[model samples]
Target: MAERSIQEVRAAQPSRDGDGVAIYRVAGMQHAAMDPVLMIDELRSEQREDFIGGFPPHPHRGMQTLTYMKHGGLIHEDNSGNRGEIRSGGAQWMSAGRGIIHSEMPTVDTRGLHGFQLWVNLPAADKMNEPDYRDIPAQEMVTLAAAAFDATVIAGNWTLDGESASGPLQTLAARAGVLDLQLQPGAAVTVEVAPGDSLLGYIYAGSMLHEQRELGPRQLLITSHGERWQLLAGAGGASLLLLRGEPLGEPVAQYGPFVMNTAAEIEQAIQDYQNGRFVPEARPLQ
Candidate 1:
């Protein structure tokens, strides 16, 4: 087995989105190496001024999103006539297959939020499938408790030392493996990932050592090669979001919320929205 090394490291850049809500974002349009993953946003703040205006009703097409909150809440409503609340440790997975309109408004509180929204590109064949939505509570996701670390499996499967766990949403298009990982201070461990899957680690708390470089909060690590990761937690302990998925290797064209395979498709998406051609309603998840 070869050792996993860093293909690249990126720090989430401070940016504003959705009515000027502050966020640390790792953008995707510029990075070809982050195949299947189009974007990652880490939203963290307690002040009302930072997150008062949430994402209003918006249109989306041809992509999937997974929202995970470490601590916080969000009220979600979509054209499907469905509404739900996502509380601490809860997650929401939505795929705007053909098209859908939705809004996500945050719950205000002293604890605020420490959460992530990740986008996964879809294969061209499934781009126009029916939209899907899911809200999963913390208790529904699989949890792995180890001596040195604790992890929440959000999607796909995780196996270590002959023990295994699978996330609730197994049908994600990219076969994504999403994990919220926390390592005790100074603890070290090795993790095995699917061979050839594109991988990323977004650090949110404390720091982690990868070879000689120490990655702190707001930093992201991508795989250069190999299937195993050597991770060491800093003295203050560490927490990170681990994501891996098979690359689609397809051409990507995106305009705002719409993602497609070509510029023409992007333009068509815009026209469709304007023409009211987008799906007017969605079917509830069965």
Candidate 2:
């Protein structure tokens, strides 16, 4: 197997989204070639604050969205009639397979709110599958403690609590892994990967030394995976999202709101939305 070393770190740029919410784009819509994991948009809001009020009713197809909140409350409603609220340390994992209309607006709160949204892409074979949702509370997240680092297993197969994280919004196992990690200052962790796999690290809080490179909040480190890569926290500890995935190795034809393998399919998706065939009717009042 080959070994990958940390290449370089790029600063995350700020972009605005729904209801004036600011999105510090970590990936997706910004860089190309990274698959399965698209973008990570962070949000914070307060009383009478309009910022990041949450995304209104929108349409998504062929992908999954993971909403993990650190603080505040979020109300989620979808055309499937599934509605719920997520608080701090909770996550709402929704799959927009085939098609789905959804809205995630924050409820009016006094103490404020903060959270991050991660976009994951479904493989071509599963793009037209059925849509679903998984609500995972903080307690449901299997937490593990290492000598210098702590990690929460989100999905796929990971040994935490002496077992693996085999649940919703998890590791697709098609050359992909996502983990939210918190490291104590001066602590380090090493992750192994396949030579053909790509490694992406996004710093959400604090700072870290990524293979001798300093990565701060909202910064991204793109590295090549050969043997393995190491991440060490700087002073004051650090929190990060570690992502690894095998290359799709296929042509990506994407436009506004839709991503597919070919241009013809992209056109078909657009036409379906325009013809009101992709979006379902709004839920009836109780």
Candidate 3:
């Protein structure tokens, strides 16, 4: 029943990734890692030049990624012979347990590509497990509609009026929760979060009042430990992404796409990639 206060507020930094796809990088702003969450990138743009190049093939290890698309489409291909398209209102969750080679490219000739890519860290114990993937379409996700607010549950459960909505991603190692929330003018919503959980929110449209502070677009809000928090939309209304997860509280060693527990493990990941041991053609999922 304690009130949640904002610990910090930071504006997203502009950056480019995946073949010049422009994005606003939030989280990981002040450190190499942020407990269970590593990075969050807001990729929303209407210009073709901002995302035409697309992301070529790449590798990842010891991490989980959740890609939620709101306005555009992305085609994903992995070395394990898995391929899919995450269209508007769809999502894709991929765990690069031990290692995985994959590529996510924007759908060509499409404008207004907008979405978010969130990176969640894997604990050391689950870092070497088998890689896995899950794709959830828009229709499959749970939605809660009300007169004052609308929300979509992406990776956890939300209950209102004795009805509950659950997301498809349930097996995350970090026990993370993801939600997309939209509030009409003067509307407010309270979200319950456990004490000691790392909670963060990114505002993409309009502004919201949280803990007596106003957060505007492109700003990231970090919350202190509390039982619950309340967010009230400004006059223009607001759309925000909410993320919460228990902290891993483990040492992290990261080098580019490789994340491990020690420097030696990071080196090993590099050597594996160089020697083709991590490639699909070399190992070939059995």
Candidate 4:
């Protein structure tokens, strides 16, 4: 197996979204090689005012969203009549196949809101399929533990102690994996990624040494082609998220909440929303 090397390191840019919720955005449409993975936003704050407003009602199309909560909680409701709450250590996966209107609000009077929202693009073939939703509690997430490291496998598979653990999110058009990893001081781990897959690491706590370079909090590291990559935690240890996916290599036309292959498609999405074509009667999930 070949060793993967760090190709670039970029700082997460500060931005506000969803009714003024502050966040650190790591990647977006400008970075094409990151296809299938459109954006990653880290929202962390102990101040109640920072996330109180939450993400009010909004519409999305041609993509899927994965929200992982590390602390605090989020209440989600959509026009499809799906409603759920994601507490600390829980996650919500929503596929906005054709279109959907939804709102994600912070639990009332809750403090210490912290989590991440990742946007994954859909292939053209499945872009307009029926929307789907999944809420995964922390208890149901696969755990991989070693002497010095622990990880929550939200998507894809991981092998530890000679046994394999697979996440609940198995069906994705782009075929991707999401892992939340924590390493103790001086700990090291090597993860295998398939050839031709794009791999990214977002450091959120402490630091790590990758190929002689030190990556600290809020840094996004992109890796070069290889079968595996090694990560070593710094003295204070490290916490990070690992995302891997196959590139879609398709044209992306995005406008607000809609993402499509061309301007015409985006226009159609807008027209659909305006005509109430995407608004399904809100029926609470049974």
Candidate 5:
């Protein structure tokens, strides 16, 4: 077991999306080696005005989205006949396989909105498969508690010190996993990751130390190849989202919510949506 070391580090930048909702762009298409992952957006604000507009109906194809909330929530409705709300500490996973129209509106509350929406690219072979959706309540996540940290597995499996826990949404592409970890002050832990897997840590609260580099909040850290990694908490403790998955090694062509393998495919997706053939009762795989 080798300790994973830093390969790259980028701080989140202020950005806007989905009808002017405030967000921090941490990672996206610009970064390569992030196979299976296309984008990550952090939505955090204490003011209602910053997020009131919400995301109106939009079409997505050839990818999956996972929305995890730390504060506030979202009311979700989609053309696939799925409707629900993911409250604070909850998560919603949707794979817009072929195509789907969906809207995620934020809940009005004093807590404001604080959460993340992640996009994962599907393999070319499965890009046109049937769409899948799931709304996981806060209590549904698997919790792993120890003296050093509290971990919630949201979409995959996690094992620490011979103990294991799995989240409710398990059928992720390329074996990707999402974990929310909170470390106590001066605490430390060694996490196991498979070799060649893409491992990233997004610090949202406090700070953390990795191989002598003290990473602050809003910093996205990408780690190099290794079978394990050690996380040491900073003075006031640390909180972060851990993303791990194997590289897809497939070509990706993306155009704002639509991801495919070629430019022609993207064009086809656009035409399909415009022609009202996006979410029919059933469509044969291409």
Candidate 6:
């Protein structure tokens, strides 16, 4: 496969929230036509001047959101009566099947917080299942490293180590790959995907030349088939998230936060929320 041109490299826009820390959003990095793995939004907050508050209770349907903490703490409460507080190294995987409502707030430590919240869209079949959440403490995650790159398999398969998060919420199918990778300087990595699948790379730290284009922090690289992309880290090294998924060939009638096959279905989702038939109050975190 020849090198594909770098599609685009754009920084995540900063979105400040009620919480003090700044939040960067990398929403729908891929074009709507590709139906690529959608990262609806991301948040990074650190304790320094003040705490980073989070989105108040909100609703979600037909998607999954994964939250991993690197530092500080996050307290989560849901209308389902569920409450969970995650500290450094902890993770939360929530699947808003048919629908659910929840809130995530920062703690008052003033130490700041750093983490990533990745949203994955559910396929047509699983879109209406009962919503669920899996809280994984940092200690429960698997960490593996190669000479050039080290990675944590948070939700999907790891071909080399064969270890992954075995919990209630997982990567889902032959359709998804969610990996957090850290590469040393001068290192390069290559990934292969099933034909017609969606592939994307997002730089979180440092920079790299990808698909013949220079990609710095916060930029995403989306690729098509017949292309073998190589990522080279800068002298300071780099960190990023690698995502791939099978394309859902069905028509995508997306409206705001909900994605369905038809506009009428999207309308139903909105009406469900308005009628309060969609809120799945949280269950107390055990």
All candidates: CA RMSD in angstroms?
Answer: 2.6, 3.1, 2.6, 2.2, 3.0, 3.8
Write one digit per residue (lDDT tens) for candidate 2, span 120-239. 777788778877887888788766677788887665444322434543455352446667889899886766656666677778899987546667888877886575676778988899
Could you tell me every candidate's TM-score relative to the true structure? Answer: 0.94, 0.86, 0.93, 0.94, 0.95, 0.82
How many Å off is the CA of 60 in candidate 3?
0.3
* Pairs of colliding residues, candidate 2: 2-226, 2-227, 3-226, 3-227, 4-226, 4-227, 21-52, 155-170, 155-171, 156-171
Counted clashes in each candidate structure: 1, 10, 0, 1, 0, 14
Q: lDDT (CA) for every model shown? A: 0.84, 0.71, 0.83, 0.86, 0.86, 0.67
Please give the range of 10 consecutive residues that has the lowest summed lDDT in model 5. 277-286
- Winner on lDDT between 1 and 2 is 1
Q: Candidate 2: count the clashes.
A: 10
Ranking by lDDT: 5, 4, 1, 3, 2, 6
Model 5 misplaced regions, further than 4 Å: 281-286
Candidate number with the higher TM-score (2 or 4): 4
| Model 4, C-alpha of 184: deviation from truth (Å) | 1.4
Candidate 1 Cα outliers beyond 4 Å, as residue runs: 108-111, 281-286
- Whichever of 2 and 6 has more lDDT, that candidate is 2
Q: Which run of 10 residues does model 4 get worst, by summed lDDT? A: 277-286
lDDT of 3 by residue, 58-136 (tens): 8899999999999889988777677888888999988998889888888875788989999899989999887888888
Q: Model 4, which residues run further than 4 Å from truth?
A: 159-163, 280-286
lDDT of 6 by residue, 96-182 (tens): 788888778877763767787776777788889887776878777777677878877666653432323323235553256666788
Predicted structure 2, TM vs. truth: 0.86
Q: Is candidate 2 or 3 superior in lDDT?
A: 3
Determine which window of 10 residues in candidate 2 has minimal summed lDDT.
158-167
Candidate 2: how large is its RMSD?
3.1
